[model samples]
Target: MQTELTLNERHLYLHRYPTRQNETLQAWDAGDEYLINHVEQLGLPPAQNIVIINDSFGALSCYLSKHHNVTMVSDSFIAHQGAKANLSRNQCVAITHLNTLNELPSDTDLVLLKIPKSNRHLSWILDKIRNTLPANCRVVSVNKVREIHTSTLKLFEKHLGTTTTSLAWKKHRLVFSQLDASPQPISPFVEWSVDGENYSLKNLPNVYSGESLDLGARFLLPYLPKDERFKRIIDLGCGNGVLSVKLGQLNPNAEIIGVDESYMAVESATLNVKAALGPEFQFEAKVNNCLDDFAPQSADLIVCNPPFHQQLAVTDHIAWQMFCDAKQVLRAKGKLLVIGNRHLGYDNKLARLFGKAQLRQIAVNKKFVILQATK
Candidate 1:
């Protein structure tokens, strides 16, 4: 994939985090280029306090940090890591990084936003921008033209004020808005419950399937293994810690860990697991990219519901990476259990990683299937 980003007649090398040799995707996209070009065209003064939201990598940060004081805000651990790596690779000046939960820097002079896939997440961010930034601060955003609907523009106008869009360039568009609205209260966490369980789940705006238990999780809940042999377990890509909570209930002796990339997801998971299993329970939630830093051959069991998409792009690389990581982290004879949509063909991928003889089907339904792979 393309690694060189040519901005203002200068080239910067960028890569996605957990950089893979065979990776075929680039770190930056047209939206990033459009924003960079727009900023260059405007000729903003140096040393401005700029806040960049949801930069997929260091594309905007690395370019802007050269002359501006940049602060990046994002929910993704991977994106943060990517930005750091790319910035260092290009020897760019260091910049501040913040998670979605952090308050915006009070002295912000400009905001550069990359529109996210989730409307709820966009709304949450817009609300925060409205509540935090000065009224005169200019807010500029970028996204694929196809992704920006009337509703999306209305969301910006509703939270901020007087939003408008530029003509499409390279199938991407730039959004401009003024922060003229009064500070509005941020939305509360969404709360829901399983049909017959007493457990209550609370999800931050960006957590996957936050409003309700998704179909795959609903189908796999009843079939979660209750074995005592599993002592150390991980819920990979644990969105709201629902799987970890259930694992805690089933395997009381196991040290349950919930791992996800999103800060909001990790926070929601921690809160949900604590509420469901209590503070005394042996459970931990972490924000990480898959099992990147996990110990080799350490886990006794790994229960995963891998995500099929990264941001707005629908791809199976995440699931493939999760399976690869699971294989490296599983101890001898340790098992990995996964639930995925049948069409995703996770069974074939698991078999490829674990060998045909080591993989087995645990359960299957109309749309979902549970597979087990022993190492």
Candidate 2:
């Protein structure tokens, strides 16, 4: 990954994920650069309270903290870990960290937000800021120019007062708005019922497969390993806890855990599991990236419908890391079952980690293939 970020008369050394191996991928993107440059160009005064939302890896937080105290908000566990590591690596001071679901810290004098892909979630966040921040707070949101649309503008206009967009520079655009007294109500949850499943699944605004089951996960459901001997099971990348809830229902004695990086995903998954499998079922859902801190040989079964993309970037590094984590965490003779697209070549990747991986054709689908690896 690129080590040095030089723009707007400042130099920053940053890395994404803290373990990013590719030399070309930089931690901060053009949007971040545009936002930072715009802030510098505006000659904004030192903020009494500066809040940064969706800072991918401490780029905005670290740089902005030098000028003003910062409160960083994020949902990804990996982002927090990476931000902390990068901040320490650069010898920057620590910033207050809060999850997106948590309330904003103090009254915001200025907000620096990075717009995400989910428009509803963006609206939800806008509502949050409108309701939480003090009146007349300065809000500046930045995104790729392509992401700036009618709804984006409308959201800011409605939640904040008199929103305006800056001219595009380096394929990025910046939005400036001043907070108003009117606070709009927002619902962060969505719901859907799956056929043949006994219960409805709940999802938060940013959770994967927002209101419905994903096609890949739909293809994976019937193939879930149902064994009587398994005592511990993990639903890797358990979006909305569908797989974990299903497994828990099938094997009532097993201890089930759902893991994901998104806080909304974890919260939705926990709710979905308990709603589907009754409150008595023992299950846990947590926000984590793959398995950075998981114990070795702890799981008898690991099931995953791993995600291939990280936001707008299409990459398999996350899935590779997840498979490696599964291999390390599974007990002796335990199994890891994964459902992935055929074009992705997950079988070969799984084989690279596990000495061997076997593939089976699950009925009713040609786009996805189920691969199982034994540790």
Candidate 3:
């Protein structure tokens, strides 16, 4: 596998999970190099406080922290973990305030951002920065040539100020936007409803499938268990808590748990559950990796709409981990309800893990299938 080889004095090794088939030749993308090159040209000394957004791995943070005091933030707990793991693997300096995107730290001097794939999430992030960024803070967003254009510039202009783009380097471009010095009002959190239920979400651009309710979630909604007395229920890999909300509404008495590797997903799900069930509704929502810390035989039901990819790579490692974790945490005869693309053949996985799998629902497009597994 290829790695991010920093300067000779310091380096960080990074890798995406499920190993890319041709990683040796791929290595870090141009976005990584562009950020590094920009820093070098500026001849800037170590920053007092630097905030990094949406760093997929340790690519940007690992390099910047070598010279600057860096605070790494990301929506994905897995990404945060990956960055730290890579830092340790390369023996880099400990990063300060390795926070999740659900909350931003105070006193940031400079910001380095990797433009996220979701525009809505990105807008939300810009809004947050608008409210907190210092008067002199510099925010640089970078992406591939096709990913940046007039629309991207407008997004930054809306929240920050007039933005400009750099000439293309290795087919990647950098977006430069200055924080507005004048005190401006921060926009209210976007209020939207899910299936007629009210919700308030604080999203950042780049959160996986953030713009709308996931289609896979819609297909699985009809199959939500109506088991009223369910003692313990979990939403494994709950993105935005849609599955958990459905489960909570159906089984009001059940103690619902929503777990995701993304801090943003956990935050969104927590908001969704509270909005759907009201303020008194209490449940456990946390940034966790597929029941990694769950106790054995602790759950009676596990509902999941497993993610199919991590970063830019499409792989089933996370889905497999969710299924395996479900099996480990579920008691004998406990059930695992899952939704996934039919092409992914999750049925075979359930069968292997639980000894039996049943098709509960299949969408008309055949793009998704809901499977139930019993341990």
Model 2 clash pairs are none
lDDT of candidate model 3 versus the reference: 0.75
Error of 3 at 33 (Å): 1.8
Q: Residue 373 in candidate 1 has what lDDT?
A: 98
Clashes of each: 0, 0, 3
Candidate rank order under lDDT: 1, 2, 3
TM-score of 2: 0.95
Q: Predictions ranked by TM-score, top down?
A: 1, 2, 3
Better of 2 and 3 by TM-score: 2
Ten-residue region with minimum lDDT total, candidate 1: 179-188
Compared with the true structure, what per-residue lDDT tens digits does model 2 show for residues 113-195?
99988887888888889888887778899998888998889888887768888898889888998876378787778888876
Question: How well does each candidate superpose onto the true structure, as a TM-score?
Answer: 0.97, 0.95, 0.87
Local distance difference test scores for all models: 0.91, 0.84, 0.75
What is the per-residue lDDT of model 1 for residues 108-176, given as tens digits with 9 covering 90 to 100? 999999998888899999999998888879899999999999999999988898899999999999999
Residue 294 of model 2, lDDT score: 94
Candidate 3: tens digits of C-alpha lDDT, residues 147-240: 8867878888887887888999989999998876343454423444555444434433444466666778767777788885579998888777
